[model samples]
Target: MTNIAPPLVLTVAGSDSGGGAGIQADLKTMLAHGVHGMSVIAAVTAQNSRGVQGYWELPPEAVRAQLDSVLSDIGVHAVKTGMLASTALVETVAEVLAGAGAPVVVDPVGVSKHGDALLEPSAVDAVRTALLPVATVATPNLWEVEQLTGVKVVDEAGMREAAEAVKALGPRWALIKGGHLPGEPADLLFDGTREYRFTAPRHDNRHTHGTGCTLASAIASNLALGADVPDAVARAKEYVTGAIAAGFPLGTGIGPVDHGWRQRAALDQSRS
Candidate 1:
């Protein structure tokens, strides 16, 4: 028999004890997309569906060692970063990923779904300077757009402006998510030239805990499988939209999107 290789997608992010976001969500998304997932934990958070109570950033050396061990061994085809809690951690991770030779998805995670701050104010400059330039695509929610590029997004026009502003920071492309915007949930994608709008009817659900991390990971997984930028984003949008729609009630507060919604559906179908 011929040897089989799994496409590896690496997540350099924090740990959400609740398993709704961060590394938990990233790994789940990779598995759902049929890719192997690896992780380099940057921070650990005492968090749950209710909110983040506390967090601790890991030492830069430890973070570096983890990245080195992975890249030197199992290797990675794509990378997605979330919750770089400090400037030091951001810089360290950037250095590790600088020559990764794989598509990088930077999700500028500023706050949690429950409004808890994850990225530090001091780290914003480091992320913009070190990571953004190396990213294949930078994914930022509207709040993160403002936090990273100082571009306040009030409407659709502002969203386009935010995407352009972020693209100017040297990333090949930028995705400005407008889920926080009122009315229809839409996300804008631009590469300093063409634009694509991804929209979905609002799910009217309060359980969207890990949507950002999930989307980025799905994009990374598709990219690892050789999909180009536009096709990767389009497929990722479809996967995440279905995840949000199939999200179930969990915990006492907010819950996670159903990363394995398709698996659950298949099981139901088999039972019929």
Candidate 2:
């Protein structure tokens, strides 16, 4: 049999010391989806189960160098960005992504799981004006949507308005996450014309530390493997729902969803 290489997916995000979110979560999600994952470490966060203690962003020149090295040589099938702390870094990443041949997923991460500010308030404008227009899909949770567009979504019906607000920012598609809503979790995907709504049984677990990152990365992975935007979002929702169900506790605080929940289930079944 011939060796088949996996689709190459690149994530330009921060590093989570706890191995739950950021670069760690992205790589794990890619591996689970059988994609070759690459990274351009945009920032480094000293975080754990409780919360983010602190973070330091890499220099813009250094970030540019890494991006150039990756794109000039081993090109990517898809790109995803998260936790670009400052305005300068976001501007730099947007510049590079604007010229990228692959589909781009932008997760406008405003705050961390522990409620710490990740992106600077001043940088929100940059994300909306510069970064979003280049995105194939922009995945913003309720809080992030409110942060970016000043639209607060309390119910499923409100997600559409939020989606419109985001699409107006110029992405080819927009996915407004309604996981923060009460009742069942619903996500709305719109491509300026049609709308796709995905709802999953809300997992009861509270240790959903990296759900946003996982969902966005999964979408990128699926896109790398040739799924359309709607199909990609649908598949990603299923994966994240399972991962959320398999979430286990860590430390004294919230934990991350099991990125390899499917593999773990398969292993358990085989042993049984």
Candidate 3:
């Protein structure tokens, strides 16, 4: 008998003690996509459904060591990054990723779901100059779009401009998420000349934490499984839409989207 391995995906991000977002969400999403998930923790947060209280960033040397250890040994097929909390960490991760021979999904995480600051104010420039340039796909929500490029997306029409501004920052594809806009959730994907729009019915759930981290990891997983940039985003959108719709309450505040929604749905269908 022979044993086979699943596609490998790596996440470089912070840890959410609440287990609803950050590395936890990333790994759960990778597992849901049937991929081997690996992580390089860049920071750790004292966080929960209520909000982020505080965060501590790891040293650049520590982050670099983890990256080297993983890439030199169990190489990844795709990589996703989130919540690099400082300028040094951002630069360190970006430098190593510039040489990593895998598709990279860069989620420019600026703030938490409760509006707590995650990335340092000083790190914003590093993210724009160093990190975004090396990304295969940069997934920025409407807030992140403004943070990174000063492009505010108020309507669907404004998302194209946001996409173009993000594309100018050097990512091969810029996925400007328009979920914050006053309509059905929509995201625009652009690669200089071509464009793709993805939309899903809006779920009326406030417990939709971890949406960004989960979506980016799903995209990385799909890419590791050999989907092209557009297809990867499309697949990720569907998975996250289901998760958001199935979100549940927790911790007396906003809870997380169900990373295992697909599995639960399948089990229920089989039983019925």
On lDDT, the candidate that comes out on top is 3
Order of models, best TM-score first: 3, 2, 1
Model 1 Cα lDDT, one tens digit per residue, 21-68: 999999999999999999999999999889999999999999999999
> What lDDT tens digits, residue by residue, belong to model 2 across residues 1-272?
99977999999999999999999999999999999999999999999999999999999999999999999999999999999999999999999999989999999999998999999989999999999999999999999999999999989889999999999999999999998888988889999899998999977799898999999999999999999999999999999999999998998899999999999999999999
- Enumerate clash totals for all models, in the order shown: 0, 0, 0
Model 1 bad stretches (over 4 Å): none
Cα lDDT of model 3 by residue, 25-112, tens digit: 9999999999999999999999999999999999999999999999999998999999999999999999999999999999999999
- TM-score of candidate 3 against the unseen true structure: 0.99
* TM-score of structure candidate 1: 0.98
Q: How accurate is candidate 1 locally (lDDT)?
A: 0.93
Model 2 scores worst on lDDT over the 10 consecutive residues at 178-187
Each model's lDDT = 0.93, 0.95, 0.96
- Those runs of model 2 whose alpha carbons end farther than 4 Å from true positions after fitting are none
Clashes by residue pair, model 3: none
Kindly report which residue pairs in candidate 1 clash with one another: none
